[model samples]
Each structure stands twice: as structure tokens, then as C-alpha cells.
Target: MLPAHRLPHLLSQAVDLQVSRCPYHFEPHPPSFSSQIRYSLLTDHLCPRSEFPSETVHILTAHSDEVWFLVFSHDGSRLASGAKDGEIILWDMKGESPKVQHKMRGQTDGIAHLAWSPDDSLLLSCGREDCPGAIVFNTQSGEVKCRVQNSAEDSLTCGAWSPDGQHFYVGGTRGQFLECALDGSVSSSWEGIRVNALAAHSSPRSVYAADTHCRIRRYNFQDMSYDNLIEEDHSIMSFTVSRSGRNALLNVANQGVHVWDLNDRCLVRRCHGVTQGHYTIHSCYGGLNDSFIASGSEDGNVYVWRSGKEKPALVLRGHSRTVNCVAWNPVYPTTLASASDDGTVRVWGKEKAALRQRQLAAASEPTGITGNGDVSESTSERRGELGGGGVGGLATSASSLASEQLDESLSAASLAEVGSDWQLAVDSLTSSMDSSVGVQPLSLPSLSSRPLPPPSDQLPADEEDEDQVTGSISTEV
Candidate 1:
């Protein structure tokens, strides 16, 4: 039997194989989700990415210090951002152009994190204030709906919504995880080491919290009991669990991009050491389909990694200061928003224009490969024409093909009637009816079996091996 903790991870991986396709490569585009960039002479900027030079998207500067967090609505139509300035700003991404929709002020000590309801109608913001430190607001009208003060003495580091959207989980100054309802009533609480980062499974049945001691713990919402996950070498500053809930992407002080397999008892499969800068990951979000993971670091760079790949697909650098948080829109897989210590929030979309230019360049390059393997006499000239366009053109075509394949496979399967012989054949191969073996080959109960058996009965070891080999041969055929 599999360990209970590893069961979820295995099941999720099996489901993902049936429902989704992994990306061949992932890359981070320009940073567009933070505030204004300013260089302080106290320390030289240490940025750890080698992928791109510099590209700016939509830069919105309003805050003075660090813009701590960014989160999106369930539909991806709206966004909410929090910062050290103790203010929250909302953005409308569905508009023709991304624009700040509304701004709400609360929490005197500064906003540490923001959590949106599963439906996206209500948003919860937590910070350090004298009395009521936590507040909930309506995203549509910029209205303050409710506030909960003295719930926790310190700043709220992170918060998550329950799977059914009924309970909210908050972690911070209290050294515990509190379960509260929509009305702000505390339902249950689990106390532990001080938590710096937090995440919950998509089902919301379980919660994962990380502390300053470099330890991760899982808490069962039902019993309020917790289990200590394996401790790493560095403190778990920030982490993001995949949408499929099978694995997590974590950033340790010394280890970067730690992929923990939730199905395998949270086993650490691979660690892609991010030495881009000497800092920790502040914020991260997994892709909607769980294909990739994106993270914002104190090094002022955004890193993107394909779900199971060891190396990062792309690194985006533009923020002159450290980035505090990064969020990706659920509706648009390629669109990202971020906030930084420089007091800016920005939005970035894939550069279709730049891709087009690359395609045009490659199509005109010299001939390298064709029906014949040898390079032609005009190879150099042909390469010059094809090199530029080839890469971009290939990307566009591959994406199109992948989309079509996904649509075709995701549709539900249909059951239809078949011939009597086929029915008999299926029954002979699959039926569980008990009957004696017949003398006539055609009349034998084993030859023509409806539904397959439960696979409880075992054939001889040699026969079982033969059957396995034959099954593979038939599938190949």
C-alpha cells in the first residue's frame, strides 16, 4: 500500500497525464507587474538571470516603498495588489488596456498579503494596525466590507481560501494557522512554528505552511492535526503549489526552485539552483493548467520554469530593485503581473511582435536541411535568410498544433454498439461469469467474454509475462 501522503501526488500525476500536456519549454517575458524602479547606492544590485536583457511592459508607479503582493480574480478579469505603504490597488485586466480600477487604503503598518475569495467577489487584506489589522473589501466597487482587528498581533504573512470557499486560512504573527468563515469568525486554529510562507491544496482539505526554521508542515483542516514535512537546509521563505495539487515549487535561501512531489510524500525530486542573485523568492504562482511555475525574487528578476523540467525556461529582468511578488492571470496563461520593493506594479504579455520579427528573419536564411542532408553551396546565404524566421515560426506552429490536440482529447468519450461477434469476443476476454471450459474453441467461455474482470485472479507467472508482452505488441500495432 502507498503511504497516505504520497497517494495524492500519484493520483494527481495520473490525472494530469490524461487531462493536460506539458510544455516543451517555458520562458519568462519582461517584468510588468511592479512599481517605479530606483537604485539605492547602499548595495550594488545582484540580479541572477541570463535569459533577456531588458523589456518593460505596463509600469504603474504609485507606492513609495515595497509593493509586497499581487493576486488575481478567479476569472482573471481583475487584480488586487498590496504593498508596504498599507494600501491596496485593484486593476482591470479585461479592459482594452490594463488600468488601475480602484484603490483602497487600510492597515497602518503596511499590507503583507492579499487573498481573494474563490468566486473573486471578496478580497481579504492583512497587515499591521493598532486595532483591527485585517480587512476585507469588495473588488468591484472599492468598498470596505468588513475588518477583523486583534485577530493576530503581528503582520499576516499569507492567507488562503478553503476548497468549498467557505473558510479562510490566515498565517502570521500568531505562529498558527486560523480557519475563519466569511463573516470573520474563527472556526479552528493550529498553532506551530512561526510561518513565513503558506499554501493550501486546491481541494482545500489540507494546508501547507513553512516557517523560519526551514520546515514545512501539513495541517488537516478536518482534525486540525498537523504533520511535519521534511526540513530543508534553508528557511522556506516562499513557495507555490501547482494547480493540479500534485507538487510544489519552493525557493530556499540556499536552494532555488525546489520541486517537491506531493504524491511521493512531498519528496524533493529536483532542485534547480537559482544563483542569479543572493536573495530569496518573495512570491510565486503556478500556471492555470499546471504547466509551468513563475517566481519573483529579491534579485529584481522573474524566473519561469516548465512543470517537470530541471532548468528554467526563461528569466525576465527589468525591475531595478527587488521584486516582492508576481501573479499570473488564470484566463491568460501568458499574461503576468508583478509588484516590487521599488514601489511599482507592472503587467506583461507575450511579445507577439518580437516573435513575428524573428520568424521573418529565419525564413530568409540559407538552406541547412531538406529532403537531402548535405548543405547546398548557397548554405551560408540560405541560413542567413532562414535562421531568423525559423525559430519564431516553429514556436507559433507548435503552439497551434498543441491547442488542437488538447481540444480533441479533452472531450468526453462516447460508447457505441458493436457487432455480436465483437460483443462475444469482449465477454470471452473480460466476463466474470463462472462456467466450465468447453471443448469447442468457439464455444469456450474464455474465448468470447462483456466487461473485463476485476483482475483479482492471477495467471501463471510465465503466462502473465506473455500477456504483458502481447498487450504491448497489440497497442503498438
Candidate 2:
């Protein structure tokens, strides 16, 4: 039932070409009607970091039960998470700290994995209910953007957006994967064994689907048929391609992480003993410089590793149960968020070195530098201090004195040039900092000037509107 506009493009492949049997294969499961265990969103009652050993750093909790899947925005400003209890929470991860900004509910049955549009304005979530499947709403505006009934079929397991975001591919319980347009129409599908995971090829709008029987097949978006792709000896729990689309990381159940070089179509490297538990690696994503790999395990840990390293860069330990999904921060490469069966979501980062690199890279961006030259002075002074030579004692003393004078001169110049805007900003910032530091300072933002969005008082009336609004046509996918 693809939209009229897209049918021509989608059906062209089936016209003259010999229809090939779907090469993707998977293990068979006896048909049963029982539902999977549902998890709830985490509650705020237990602190997020309590499950971990650290204390100074606080955790941001939003769900009251298990989080089935979580993904960060393309720019990393926000996060979208779906729970087994049919709750969808959107978190603002930017600013000095992170907080849950919105919670959406519409799907009666628990939601499965979710895919964000490339530009991050809209989200598409699919699940099963009365029949086999239903796709419903959990968007930013709370609008039910679109809903689809799958001719009464089981729920879809995983899905991925095409690079252009105009279309998406979904894998279903019936051992088939289908491609459809955003307008709610199935364009094409390959009927096969149970399709567990699907990923959009990095270079083309084409897609790759992995079945339960350890087979991976590629399909060209231009035509809806399978292309010969690589396969594994065991079922692939997860797979991620590098930024350059040259290499891939594949996680097979109980087989650790496998590195496949797509260029050569051969296995290049493998890390042993990564999959200790029976749990599958739900998600595999590339990290900073495309040198690192980030994975969430059913064993309840988020592990970060490099290409050649036997040991992991960081092992994030927090979730009480298995970690089902994870997403890397696009803007902050070292940061990753994980959702667990224990109903908690944890944001993990590599050690100090990684954090330091991330911070430096962040600060180096033109947009990162803000408000006058106040912060620049501090950075410049530190660089100078670090670069200073180990000269004779008297010369070192003279140089040190000269550097101190230069610092004072720069500081004065910055203050003078900042003018009124700088003063007001500095005062507001200092006041906030003082409060956080346990020292009362100056006044806060004027209540009249900083009007908050309609509070909980206005939420009830807006609830319907918020839950059903879709992004503008101009909105980023």
C-alpha cells in the first residue's frame, strides 16, 4: 500500500528483473502468541548513580521502568527513549546538565526500537497490538504524525531510516523486511526468515538486513531486491559501519565483536570473550575518529573499545539488568547513552583523557567560544604557563612577572570591551555559579522577563495537542 507517488520508483525493480529468493535466512521459531516481558520506565525515587560505585557525578533518570531503546539526536542536544511499558521520554542532554524535557504516550503495547530522522525533528516508532503491528505517535509536539496497520501482523523488531530520511526499512517477526515511505505506505518487501536487525548502508540509501540464521543481505534502494552481502557463522546480534563505510563492527551472540572490512569482504579482526552472557549486543555504533566502538550488552554493561586493543577503553557499570540499546553522542563523540532492562538509562564517557579530548575539541569549535573574550583570557594564560621555558632562575622569575602583568592587562581589556552585555551576563552567571557552589550571590533572572512555558497547570489542555502534533514540512527529518 505504498503512496501513489513512490510506487513507480519502488516497483521498477520487480518489472523486468528476475525475482530472486531472499538470501537472508534465520532460525525458525514455533509459532506462538505469547508476548515478551514488558519493562517500565525508571522512577526518580532511586538516584540514577546509586547502581554505580561513583557518587560525585549524578545520573539523569526519566523512566519508571525498563528502557527498551534510547538514541541521541543527530546533533546530540537531546535523547529519545522508548520503554517496554509504552512510554516515550525525550531528554534534553545539552546545557550544563541534562534533564527530561518531554514524555509521550500513545502506543498501547510496549514500543520497540525507535529511529530518529536525520535532522532530529521527528521520530518514528512501531509496535504490535491487536493484529501484527502498528506505528503510532511519540513526536516532539506530541502529535500522532501517522499510524499504520500491517494487515494484522506481528510487531516489527528493528528499523532504520534511509540516509535521506525520505524512506525507512523495518524488520518484522514474520521473517520479512519491508521498505516504506514516510507517508505510511509499504513500498517493497523481501519475504524471508525472521529479520532481526536492519541498517541503512553508509554510502547509499540501500539497506542491509540481518536474519536469525546468521545471514546478512543487502538490498539496493533503487530496486527492492537482495544483493549479495557478507554473512556470519552465527546470528549477528548487532552491526555498525564506520563513518567512511569501509569497515564494520559485528556482534554475534556469545562471539564477542567481529571486525569486517567491507572493501575486502573479509574478516579483519575479532575481539574474544566480549559476549560473556547469553545476552545479545543490541546496538553497535562507531565512535570518535571511527577508531573506537561502543556497544550495549545484554549483560548490563556498556563497553567501549578500540580497533586493536584487547582491553576496553571504558566499562560503564550501572544497569541492574541487561542493557538492550545505546546511542553515541554525535557532537560529543566520547559520550554515549545506554538503556537497560533495569529501567534506568545511563550516560557514560571514557576516562579523563577521553573527556579532556572531547572538551578541547568542543572548545575549539567556532560556535563553542561565547560571550566576549573573558574565557579566552583564561585559556591563553594556561597555554602560556604550560609553554614557558625552564630558563635560569632570575630569567624565569622575570618572565613569570612579565606573564602576570600581561594577564592583568588582558583581563582589564576584556572587562572594558565586554560593556553592558558582558556585565549583565557575568553577574547572572556568577550568581548561578555561587548558588551551585554553596555561596549565595547576586539576583536571579527577572521573573517578568523570563516567562516559563505554560506550566503543569496548562499541560492538561495542551496534552492532546502536544501528543498529536507533527513537525512542519520544512522540519528536518
Candidate 3:
């Protein structure tokens, strides 16, 4: 009885769930091959995310202005970045060093976001209100294909290409929602709510948009109908959809990143530890099989979290200013890229040399890794002190004591396992699974867990929310 559009979306979610592709699922005893891999993420991963992309391999400084957004191509072979100075730099990521494949310039002001077509043949870029021009570029040749300008009265703010690659959906601050073809033609247009972000779904033939008022809604083009997906107390900054199109990650003002189950239409998890007060922070679904989540923080750090948990499993520090965007390589599980207000883009991944150095350091420690693959008093104490105090009261050192964290010998194998297929990794995951026999991912008790407060319909109390960092513009259009 479901519509044709709805059937495709439902099937995709069912397949993704049946395969146990999401490591965040809270099943007690999952019987799928992916379940074994889930435990690998929790147990095989060490503090500081030992095998994760903790080392910065490349630092790109071509932009004279602060970088606003970053996105990896569908093939994961190239990365494109946009900056406040209106330049788009494409980097070839296949080499030992990421070199500038092409430098594109079109807009006069900042570039708010970038999108790569599903075929990887073209790029759609949304500009700030100062310029209000959307440009489509031929990715292979770095040539401008077409340009779509805003109306004299209002400007476009966000865009995303549809699954069929014929046209894209764009939204404006003044509620101009339209479908535009690549040839600089408008296919269809509508008057919708003011939008801050846009994501397109092919299966359901729908578009999901987040407005400045902290509300998310879905618009089905076929039926010309809409439904509410999420409503938060704080203003929404950005939204990232999962590969399966079943989940979304939202970066909100004053609140940290949140994970929402699109199928269930509920806030599943609120990633904590790190905080955000202002500006749009973009987050993504990454890691092997999209089991892990990563987000750029307003505090200049990149946080990585296990999908099921609320607290970040690892915090990466290095950026000197707010890290506005992050992208993980879809092909290479270990590689990650982050853009910052400090006018630089940094690449991170597992480094064998650094792994060797850590191995030597851990080998020399007086209290080294124990037989059970757990770190000794030295490392455990540091984690304990950090996770000691509770939100209100009680202890939460389960992360420190619940599992053995650092074992140098496990680095190479874990990195390989991270990128391995569940079918092929069954043996390795089961072997390491035995070592983590008793170590379980911690969950807060019901007595201590608090339900989300009812959402308020009032505007955000932060008086400067409108002026401080909304799209780097002085005022909303």
C-alpha cells in the first residue's frame, strides 16, 4: 500500500539494518557478520583512537580566507574545498601527497557549500548572499558549465543534486524552493519554508530541508506534500544524511551534534563531551561500513564517536580556530579531512611510522599493556581522571575500566580489520572478540538517564545568534 517513492526508501533501510551495517545498533546479541565487526570497533579501538586517523598528513594553505566547507567526491578520488575568498580548490587524493588538481574561482564573496554530482562529472556550488550566484563546474576539466543567479529580491542559500543527476533542489532564506536543471533552467519551483540546508533522496523522490527555526521537514516532489521530521529547541546549522538515507546527523547552535533515525523519526542519540555555541558545524557518517561518526566542533577540535553512544570515543586536537567542516574518504576508511577558520584544510589518517613510534613508547613504559590487551595503570588513570565526575553525580569510568584500550601489536591488524569486509573479517573479529570477552560498551542506567525536555517554540535566547556566524553574513537575507 506504500507509494512507489516510499517503497525504495523502506527497502534500503531494511537491507542496511538486516546486514547490521550500523555499529550503533543496541541489539543484545546480533547474529549478523557485521555484529562481530561492531565489537571490533569498540574493543579493537584504543584510547585517542590509536588506529584511527589521528595523524595529520597534509596541510593545504591555498585559501587566503577562512575555509567554509569541504566535500569528497563520490569516488573518493578527489576532494573539493570552498573558502570565504570565493575560491574552490580541488585536490587529487590518490597520490602520496594531495596536490591541487584545479583551482576554481567564480563568486565574489564566500562559497557557502559544494556538491558533486553522482556521476562525478559536475560540481554545484552555493554562494553567500553577498554574491548570490550558483555555479556548476565540469569536474574533470575544471571549467564552468553554467551559472544560476538569484532573484533581485532574494538569494539562494543551499542546494543538492537529485539521484537521477538531471536537476538539483535549491532553497533560499526567503523560502524560495526550486528544482533547477544543469543547463541553467528552472524545472519546477515552490514556495516553502526558509531553508538553511537541503538533502535529496531518490528512493522516496523527496527533499529534506532544515530551516533556521530548528525544524526539519520532508517534501515529496511527486505528491507535492510535506511532513515534519525533527524539531529541536536550538537553531539548526547543518544536516548530513547517511549513505543508506535512513539516518541524519544535525549540527545545532548551542547543542552538540545529534543523530536522528529518519525511519523512526526520533532523536536517537546526542553526541556529548564536546560543545557548540555558534556557527554552522557540519558532521558526517564515516568509518568502515559507516559505523562511526565524525563532526567538526566550534572549539577547533574534531570529535569521533561510536554510533550507539552519546559521548565521543576520541577527540582530535590541532586546529587553532573553529573547524567548520569535515569529510571522510568513502573509499579509504582511515583518511579524513577537516576545514577550519584558521584558513587551512588538514588531512588525517593512520601512519605506520607514527604507529611504530607509539609502539616503542608503550614498550618502554614501566606499566605497559597487560596480557589481556588492556593498558596498565598509567594510561587507565588518565582516562579515569577524565571520565571521573558524572553529569550530576556518580562515576562513569566504564570507558577506562570496561575494556583494554592500548596494545601496540594490534595497530596494523586493527587498521586492516577496520577496512575489511565483514565476510572476510569474521575470523579476525572473532579472535579479537575473545580478548574483549568481558569488555562491554557502557550504557547509563535508566535512573540517571534523563528524557529530552519538550521543545520550545520560542526563538533562541542568544541575542547574537543572528549576527555572530550565520553563513558569515551580517544579517539573514
Candidate 4:
């Protein structure tokens, strides 16, 4: 007879088999509905499977000071991070271990924001208030392409590249918003209340800017007129729009994270419990198809939340100081990178087979007798060995043992399929489901039969208006 503790695992496997056998039953339903069923079957059970590994796989200690900002290239080939010491490091992600490809010097006052051009040929770095200019660099040579100097009375705080890749926009503390050509010429200038954050959306051909008064304004590129999108009660520090342009994530000071539905023009969810003090911390959309939201916390940890969850799904502890930024790999959905005041960038990802082994080992502790006269003495001995150590020590041992199991199970592709299926379920829940469903269902797919759309076909073209040149200037650095 099978052990009572093994029933859940067997039942889960049986459900997976059923799902695989009649894949057509789910084909007729919307992806979101099918995903909801999958998520419920996988996570809502008494013994749940692990969604992702909660440990850091790689630690990158290349920067000397607090790391502030991280951004991946448009094609997701390289990742760039900025630090408090004004150094920008480019990481090559093709290898097993991330290697520094370029270490370029940025603003002296420290880098505040980074934006990559749509074509990925150029990078824009916005400096802190004390610095008078933003720097544009050539991605290949790491050479300074141009310097955009603000007037003595103005300082840049945020920036974004235009969809057409011809010009970029920069916002300053003095409420100055300017459109500049790649050759360092100011095309147009406008004034607003203090601009704190700027985001460009191509589909609407508009730019979204958050001001100090807790107001978000949309500037239409076609009409050159701007209007208020939404006004909040808290000060807006930073915000990022998802690649799909369906939702926007806002970081309100001391108010946690807010998700806004662009179509409905309403707040969908607010994820709390992430420590956000006076300092500015950035949040981003990542995971599979932007299904999860990740942010750095002042409490020296990275918090990840599913789009539908009101609280954090995972709290990753590795940084010794405040974490400042988190970026997800666009091409590879599983990989995540976080930068911190601890002066290191940590990379995280799911380890399927290893995580399963650890979970199975942890769940194997016998609570009752088996069909035999008594449980084996070896099982009792293993339990005693595990219980003999302190909690931290036991956790370490379990991780080590799981790593060993993973080394042996690496040949099996089923583990990889498990992660892939979960990712697909998440993508379907977030992207296909309408707002009427409230929060996305907390579930995952039982089968890995669904294929992901091609990267090119996944993103729609951003609708933007033609650049309207209003002014010009000459500068060199």
C-alpha cells in the first residue's frame, strides 16, 4: 500500500495526466479561464507544488557603491545597471555566469534613471539633481555620444526614449520637459508642475508624467495637448508601464504599490507590506508576460507579487542594505536581477527539480505509521538527523541535498516543463483575462502543451505621432 503522505503527489500527477490526455477540452475555453483552473489545481491543494525557488543563484558584486537603477536592452541581450558612484555596468547574459562587458562612467552626482532606445543602439542616463546634464552613450563602444546639459537653474530627474527612436524626453526639477534630438538639439520645451517620473507609451503616442502634487498627466503627441489621467492622494515617486501597455505600476511614497488599469482608468490592486521609507525605490513588471510585479524594499529585500495578489508572493532576502532596483529578463522569463545599497546585484530564477526534491524531503517526515508494522528505522534516523540541527542549519542541509538531487535529475526535461507550464499559466491569467475577473486567479497550468508566442509577435507596435521640432541647440562633451 502507498504511504498516506504520498497521496497528494499522486493525485497531482493523475490530474496532470488527465489534462494532457484531453487538451482539446481546454482549447475551446479562453486562456485565462483555463489558466485559472490550472492554478487552482496546482496551488489550492493541501500540498502545493513550489512555484519558484526562493534562493539567489548568482551574486554580482561589480559596483563599489549603492546600485540605483537597472534596465534591460530592448532585445533583452544585455542588462545595464547604474550605481551611486555614477558608474554604469553592462552585463552580458548569454553565458552561464553573467560577465561585465563594459564599465562606463556616468554622471558625477550619480545616475538617477536609465532608458534604452527602441533600436538598442543608444542608452540615456539621467543624473541626480546636482548634475547639470544627461549623458547619451553608444552601446557598442561605451563612448559618450552626446551630453544634454540643462540650464544652471534646472536639473533633470527622469527621462524616456520616443517610440520612433528619433528623439528622447527629459524632465527636470524646475518643471522643464524638453524633447531633444540625438545630436544634442532641443526640439521643443514645455513647463509643468514638478515632474517626478516620466513614461512613454507608443500605442497611444503619448507621454505620461507624474508630478509632485500626486497627479498623472498624459501628453498627446498628435495634438501636443496634455490632460490629467488620474490624481492620487499620495506623492508619486516612480512608475513603470508594462510592455503590453495594458497596466501601469506606480510607487507611491509610503503607500505601497498600486496597479492601474489603463482601459478602465481605475486602480485595480494595491500590494502592501513592502517597506518603502523616504527614499525612492523603483518597481517593474516581469515574470512570465509581466504577470508578476517586483520591487526593492528599504528593509534590504526584494519583494515579488503576483498581479492578482494583494500581498507579496515572495520576499527574497540577500542584500545587507536597502535594495534600490529590480529588473527582469525580457527574453528569458525566469531570470530576475536586483540591485541594492549593499553594492551588489543578485540574480534569481526558478530551480524546478531541485525545489521539488527539497519540498518532497521536507514533506516526507512521517506523522503516522505506514501499512507495515512500523516505519523504517532509516526514515527515523534521517528525521532525527534533520531535527538535530538548528533551523538555519537544517535549511542549509536541505538546500545542499536538493542541489545534489538536481545534479542527478538535470537530464530530465520534465522539470523544465513544469516551470514552463507555470509561466504560461501566469501569462494567460494576466494578459488574456479581463478586469472583470478582479485579480488574476492564483493558479498554474497542469500541462506544458501550450507554446509561447514569438517575441516579435508578442509586442504590438507603439502608436506615436511625428516629432514636432520647436527649437534647436548645439552642445559637446
In the order shown, what is each candidate's alpha-carbon RMSD? 20.3, 23.0, 15.3, 18.3
Residues 168-228 of candidate 2: C-alpha lDDT, one tens digit per residue: 7777657657677777688877766477677768645587777777867777757655665
Q: Give lDDT for model 3.
A: 0.67
Report the alpha-carbon TM-score of model 1 versus the true structure: 0.60
Q: Extract clashing residue pairs from model 3.
A: 374-404
Candidate 3 is scored at a TM of 0.67
TM-score-superior candidate, 1 or 2: 1
Candidate numbers, best lDDT first, in rank order: 3, 4, 1, 2
Q: How high is the CA lDDT of each candidate model?
A: 0.56, 0.55, 0.67, 0.67
Which candidate leads the pack in TM-score?
A: 4
Q: What TM value does model 2 have?
A: 0.59
Model 4 weakest lDDT span, ten residues long: 468-477
Candidate 2 lowest-lDDT run of ten:
468-477
lDDT of 2: 0.55
Could you give me the TM-score of model 4 versus the true structure?
A: 0.67
Task: Give one digit per residue, the lDDT tens place, for model 4 in 28-71.
Answer: 22243334344344222211112343445455667888899998
Model 2 RMSD in Å is 23.0
Per-residue error for 97 in candidate 2, Å, reads 2.2
